[model samples]
Target: MSERHPRILVIAEAAHPEWVSVPLVGWSLAQALRDVADVHLVTQIRNRDAILRAGLVEGRDFTAIDSEALARPMWKLAETLRMGQGKGWTIVQAVSALSYPYFERLVWQRFGPEIARGDYDIVHRITPLSPTAASFLAGKCARAGVPFVLGPLNGGVPWPQGFDDIRRAEREYLAPLRAAYKLLPGRGATLHNAAAILAGSRHTGSELPASARHKVFWLPENGIDPARFNRVAAPGDGPLRACFVGRLVPYKGPDMLLEAAAPLLRDGRMVLDIVGDGPMMPGLRAQADGPGSGVTFHGWQPHEAVQDILSRAHLFAFPSIREFGGGAVLEAMALGVVPLIVDYAGPGELVDDSVGIKVPLGTREAITTRFAAELARLAKDPGALAPMAQAARDRVTQHYHWTRKAEKIARVYDWVLKGRPEPKPDL
Candidate 1:
């Protein structure tokens, strides 16, 4: 390895050069390290056009692997079946079963030999935190004498501010999986293969095995491209425009937002603009058209359009209870829109007293009550919302920029290559 620069490999299951924040993480890392080292990004490529549009220069510091080519036909059929099984199926079984294996065979196998041949200094594995893929790639890196880092290791349920509510949700969703995950072969492999682990949140960092906790590092949830989400002051005139962007899933709490808006509509307070589409779209649309609901479902818009919508929005309502990192929240914050996030996992880290309101998570009634109170307060006090919006923009500009995130990640790669420990941040 060169004394000045180190070769790095980034492996992820998601298709790169896309709108998704996961792929953007890999892309940003590659861009950051291009000047000092050889960076090869190995990821699934769903849309070649998107990859090209991303300005990825092949054979020069970056290369992409298409995971679809390595996918088994039976796997696709199984995934189709699983997706058809609805939300519960997608959450419980399909996510780990169908998606994990695809990464193992296609992503791992396709990129492993190339990584080995390159004599990489470090290997960074991105999210979903598949023990299978982590094990396979970690093994490959280990055999090649390269240090392996697995992370952002997301997928944990949100942590409610109330200890009882958080404990209850953990018992229902995470407790059962712990026993099963311990028995998986990949779990053992992951422990043995990885030299270090990175977590996006304190909650996820705590979830790491006792053996891996020593090497665990915590980074902010998401990085934002400031150009995309430019700051805009809310107009103090007509009805306020509130927007919710993301998949229309139950976990995302779209229904809860709809419910919160229902009371507001009865009093003629504001209008709700719902962007993105999924299985819950029909139900969301039904609620919008139904009496006492003031929601407008815009269906799925292009990535570029999301920025435009956020620019016009007065507030960003994110009620998700199971996010590891709130990427959309960061985008909104960068755009100078105040975020109303739940006091759970991802958004919890992003929203503070200065930036936005964080409602405590609880039973349906508790959540609804908090949302109603906060929404009403924001709607009534126009002056209060302005400072929070400015704080959000200032916070993003100072700490959450993509360039800063990439620099930190590159430092980790350097430390691993030199067989040195990560330095504790001077808080």
Candidate 2:
């Protein structure tokens, strides 16, 4: 509400410019916020070099906290217990919850006095995007009479029914006990003391206590950098070019997507480009090895290269069953590649009839059948997809770009600073 830009201390422990998923989300969002506010990012020391390389001056634009004293060991322990990489994400988050407090304590020790003296207009924790990771800083900020904003917190989408096998395959054994995070120390204070909450999904919103619902704003955590994903899709005149970019793991449903596109692949009416590596790679390769399969395995691309390959495709068919925040799907849309995703979780919420298509959630066989049918129809008349493809691009440009996300967040900052006025319509 002030004439000057608001001062924001953005905390993102996992933020790294070169990483993907939550780390990338944290980095992108924190960087984007600089356009809207005077942002000083506080992140884990591990990301210090990358942040510096990205041109932010240490001790001025950002502060790197060395919490690896506890964080590193806990992470290794989590890796051992998780069985392998790309599995047991819940286990990783569970362990992260244990070590994250140390990072916050160091943050408080370094900045408490400045906060108490009102050096920053807002203290926003952008990462530990998981709702399970509670913040003690919230209560501390409250005591100091400074507003602390939490989230766009996202995660904890229940494993859909009939996907128990896929759940087990992903090593998500701790999923059932995910609710126990509600009892974690500081969980209540984190909810009660926060000035505003940005729930990344309806599921994450429901997880918050009813008393805190008044401050909840629905905002998905995933966003795309238009500069990187600026290329437009160049759909060809041959077979319909479709891509699937994510881990080849079961929950992401690479196998299901392969089976679904089998008929089109076998008939030379479609081509599949799979980008990413995971534990399920060998099996997925075998599934697509037959003659006339029209499948190319381009595993684990650099973040920049993904758009180059994706922009050449006509569709992004993602069958992920339990995605918390479908960043990959958003990337596809940003490239003007119309997405065909399972109507569940994050991607389902992102796509609607005007921009992209959604297939109903069901057993593997049912999903495959529906996807096959949709692909067949699209292949029959590829020209019909042009409208939807353009719409997808327009939507991402207007609302899902990193700059747009930052502007929306600025609105939240204004609402909180203006004494939580009635009918905060922008949110």
Candidate 3:
């Protein structure tokens, strides 16, 4: 291990500065790492313009691999298979499994010599965060004696029980076939050869084979860029101001959130701000339209508007049942708004009693009841939420900020370079 900063080749095929979801995550992480390591980012050609706009010299700071010949066609196929946009995410990933190899193959073709000669201390693949997306670089780097790090790999959270109707509505037809990813080519070799694996969630961490468990470390893939989400909610003298920001789809439980908060909205005990749009908009709008139902629908606001609404909010009432990363929850928490999320999957894992609230997972009716009860209780005593909101903000600053995540990843780089030390980083 070098005493100087580790030279890392960060591979994030989906990274893009202007996008959200996986692309933003990959872009944020890759940029953050530059402060701690000698990072050379390699990404797909589609992100080249965005990367250039962000001020990086092409072929010097990064290299854009043109894999569109295969990626474009495969992406079109995935779009068709998904049935509709933003639906059938599982189907998209399942189809992408076939085309991702081409990107890595081109990456190796260009960088193999430098990697083989030990020019880079480590090769870290940060995107295609799906645990199912096997890496060709893992075995290649392993054979070259250069340590390779995989993930904050997330996804593969099974649809929880009692959500079959919503699952079908969301067009997640391929979810039952998700386990077949383990049988994909290079899946075994990628896991077996990686020097360290960063599992983004506990569910994802548990999915790795027993042999790979020893090298795995828990690190949530979602992170907050403090500058983007720095607003702190100032609870004024009024009803509890709550907001729900996500697609108005069955799985996100927007309808359930509306049902739960309906009483409060009608009684003037709470004000609800719904900050997104989806297929269920017309139905949800109708559901909220009665006397004194203080529900405001700011349909599909930009990130800035979302943050504006969240900053003035006291509670973030997001009842998403099967969220994998829960990035919106983090965004809300970053704004010092206490989140009330279901006690399952990503939200359950990100929050605890000190920072936010979590209601037990159950059927749609049961969850709605629980959420309603919690919202009523909170509305009755809004002053008690202040402490939790501050704690949530502090938690994000310490752990969930992109800078902090980069620092933690730097520690990971050190650990892997130090020959697999005992007591892995408990980040």
Candidate 4:
């Protein structure tokens, strides 16, 4: 008798061919496990052209659920106005009217039926806890007698201790909103329903309940395809070209980068290339376009373009303090761009003394000073950059490869099904 390969179902809002890291991780896992397991992916919606280009066998192995049928009228209204015109009265009104019904009808209604029909050994519900999606999927998976896995890989971000401090400091202002959102039906139920949880980093793993902690797995959110991130000798160029690729958001710290680059601009030691778009773009542009603005914001580019940009750059600047998985950091590192990360949760786990610089976390001045110093040092000695860049590439090639990540995930499925003990790696 032959051993049966476990059948796994990955449920997420996004899926392959999309440029986002979460979807790309799902795509990579599905492709890696196709030869071994019967893998099926169910996502809300995606670009057909991108999925096709990813070379996934659609319908045969990968499938997407159309929630358009279950979508409420108010949901369309919210999306149409760009989520309440991006803020203020419109945002509050739109969220109040659309948030609940949107989750209950569009997400849960479609996700529940899919879970009931699919005989999956393990159901990985990505990022459903934020809303009511996880709770709904948990109930459906329970009915189907399958284990449910929760985490950023499936879509739950692990908040760090520093975040807790921030929450505590802002609790007076934020508690009411948090309480109101928690009051929504199905919030606590989701956390209670999950069978296992996975975090993208150690900091994230710390957020899980004591009971869920044992089940939690720490894996990077995305893996690199080595062929794509290969290292080439540095050009030993003029001013070091530093790249920052991601959504320009307050939490991402693009503003911090701009502030840091201000002094560097005066000295002409570093040039900043900002690639991405978000609510903070206008303000970031204002800061970068000023008299001493050395930063160049390139709105947004396609995923491939970002990769090409990383390959040509000398370093990657990622100052995000709220991120759970710094996919862009890993992507840049794989392409031989030395990553300068804040010594916070996500990036701290990916970078160390050997691979890249981990700056101490602080407000604008502290962060900017640390980053500027590192940039200056690297710019003066280009030879020092190659070793760290090579180490970064090697780290991804050896430990964070998609095949290895998928295999570990597959083992977790086996453990959930057969009641096997967890595999312990060498200490």
Candidate 5:
């Protein structure tokens, strides 16, 4: 079995294709891994129906562990705190940290015998993407001599200075407290016991304990399904068509985008397509309607409609200040749309001069100034768009596609099994 496709038990606390963000990541990643490994996905009972709808036999392809009795109270509290937006997401994770172990314990209770019998080559915990959460099965895998893998775990990027106002608006007061997570029970042991660890960003990698740093490899959490983000034959030759796709919020910087792009919008030099709705929408609409404004507010477009908009556009100007998983950015890139994002956090790490444009992190006024200048430069010279757009497509095809990511992680599994310390997977 070791010589063939390595058998894997993939543990995902949140996984369902119908779900977005981390849950969608869990679904996409687990399915992609099956292309290279013999995988039996294990997820929370909440995802059971969706998984079945996607056509997998229960007990054979996947197993749903039921622990709602232990997790319901915390979940309910988090939902109440959520108040219908992203503010509650952090609270959900905080509550989930306490409940995750019970679910993992149930996984071990049911699958422990098979692991001990060497029925599977490895056990990997793929979600609860936060490093703050503790893993329950690392020690059990060690005792059974089955290698354990943790992460692409992400989070804990310090809020960039000068964004205090935005930080407050974002309800991220708990971000600084994340350093305290290192002291969480079993975190150190979880890091120490894992055969290989994949960090989703540079900060996440840097946050790992010194002892475990050597085995840690860098891999971002975002991966594009080519089927969903298909490439276009030829981009439109119309007005420098640009779009911003994300929630309308201060941290996402849609307001900043509007401020910068206003000059180009005047006199019909460019047309801005705003594809999402948020608290900032009313304010953004007012701003976009002002002098020299050629912006269209296509408030809250559906998933497929977003792709259609990108397919016809030349540039995707998303100037988000603190995006962790720039899935939208990657989706735009996969469709040959040139991305313009800030140079900090995930988008900063993902896009370079080679792929798309990067505006350095700074005060809002300064970023708006530089961001507008870059857009103006590109608008003035349309020739630069094609090459950068092509480069963006190539970068995602080479590095960020789902199946490519799956193959790279399969190599990590091989690397862990060989017990080497010098070379990490070049993800």
Candidate 6:
């Protein structure tokens, strides 16, 4: 291992920036770690061209392992079952669970010899962020004497009890069945051998075996890229511009935000910019009608455009019911747009009192009423916005930037390899 920095072999089976959101984290984290660590990313062959386009040289910065022979069959099955994206993302993950072992097996087969020969200082599994995807290579790393780090793994966020209707609409029938994953093969070994396990949310951490909780670190999976989110909101003199950026889906709760904001929007007291498209778009548009609905649907804008909208808006409103990672919330915070999020899963972990407003989970009507009241309070008190916005931006800058998260990873590496003590618990 080089004395300059720990040589990290980052394995991400699903890293592709061109795809939807989750993979972006993989790309961002792997790249950011290069800022402080000698990082060599290893991902599936599917991500090769995109990785190459991102200017990462082959063999130098990363190694693309092709496991398509095994993965494609599982992928086809998931697709055949009409479960691919949006409401179907969970089913895709279910299929991924079946195929991930093969991906890791290939990685272990390729890198096992080097790892055994002490070629790297750290072995980090940065993706399959789902905590249920137990690492097949953990035992190999343990036997080889190189420390392994799993996570920031998230998932296992239960359906909020009162939202039975929304859960049905989102087709989250398997959510209740998620507990069965804890009984999957290798989970015990994966937990026992890891030097550190970073849980992305309290829900995920609680799912860890009680004996392994000591190894758990509360590190949220979502983080902002400062360069992309450098714009500060300029909330103008007219209507209080509030924006919601995410798929227009049931779980994302865009409709809940709209229902809550309806009164404020009707009076022209607030305007909303909904920057995404999904199955919920048609229904959401129907709800956006009256004179001052003030809702502008910029259907599925590019990443740059979403940032532009966030830059001009005053507040970011998102009320996802079971969010595993609220990366969008951090993006808003990074842009100095105060976030108004549901106080439940991932967003609950990322936002604190000083940075953002949290609406306690409740029945649909109760949550909508509470959410609207918060909006009305913020609207009535314009002076409160700047401080909250500043704090939100400051929070992300200090704790939720990809580079900042990478630096934290470096600290975890130091503790694992240099015999330093674990950082204090987040509670």
lDDT of each candidate versus the true structure: 0.68, 0.90, 0.91, 0.64, 0.85, 0.85
Winner on lDDT (2 vs 6)? 2
- Can you tell me which runs of candidate 4 are displaced by over 4 Å? 45-59, 70-118, 127-133, 153-176, 179-189, 226-235, 278-297, 424-427
Local distance difference test, candidate 1: 0.68
Q: In model 1, which runs have C-alpha deviations exceeding 4 angstroms?
A: 1-3, 32-36, 45-49, 64-75, 83-118, 127-133, 158-179, 231-233, 289-294, 419-421, 425-427
Query: Over the stretch 104-179, how does candidate 5's per-residue lDDT look in tens digits?
Result: 9999999999999999999999998999898879999999999999988987777788898877776766776767
True-vs-predicted CA distance for residue 258, candidate 1, Å: 2.7
TM-score of 1: 0.83
Q: List all candidate RMSDs to the true structure.
A: 4.4, 1.5, 1.5, 5.1, 2.0, 1.8
Better of 2 and 5 by TM-score: 2
> TM-score of each candidate?
0.83, 0.97, 0.98, 0.78, 0.95, 0.96
Residues 1-427, candidate 2: write the lDDT tens digits. Answer: 7588899999999899899889999999999999999999999999999999999999999999998889889999999999987889999999999889999999999999999999999999999999999898999999999999999899999999999888888889999889999988889989999999999987889889989988888889999997778899997788799999998788888888888888888888899999999888988889998545799999999988999889889999998888998898899888889999999989998999999999999988898899889999989877788899999999999989999989888888988999544334235
Query: Clashing residue pairs in candidate 4, if any?
Result: 126-154, 126-155, 127-154, 127-155, 151-156, 152-155
The local distance difference test score of model 5 is 0.85
Task: Give the better candidate number (1 or 4) by TM-score.
Answer: 1
Order the candidates by TM-score, highest first: 3, 2, 6, 5, 1, 4
User: Clashing pairs in model 2?
Assistant: none
Span of 10 residues, lowest total lDDT, candidate 3 = 418-427
Structure candidate 1, residue pairs in collision: none
Pitting candidate 2 against candidate 5, the one with the higher lDDT is: 2
Which residue runs of candidate 2 sit more than 4 Å off their true CA positions?
290-292, 420-426
Better of 3 and 6 by TM-score: 3
Residues 1-427 of candidate 6: C-alpha lDDT, one tens digit per residue: 7569889999987788766566888888888999989999999999999989989899988999999998989988877664436565567778889988999999998999999999998899989899889898888999999999998898878888888777777666676787898798989999999999988888888889889977788888888887777788887777678999988888788888999998888887888999998988889989888444699898988787789987888899898877888888889988889889889988988888898989888878788889899889877855568888999888888888888888888888888888676675551
lDDT at 102 for candidate 1? 60
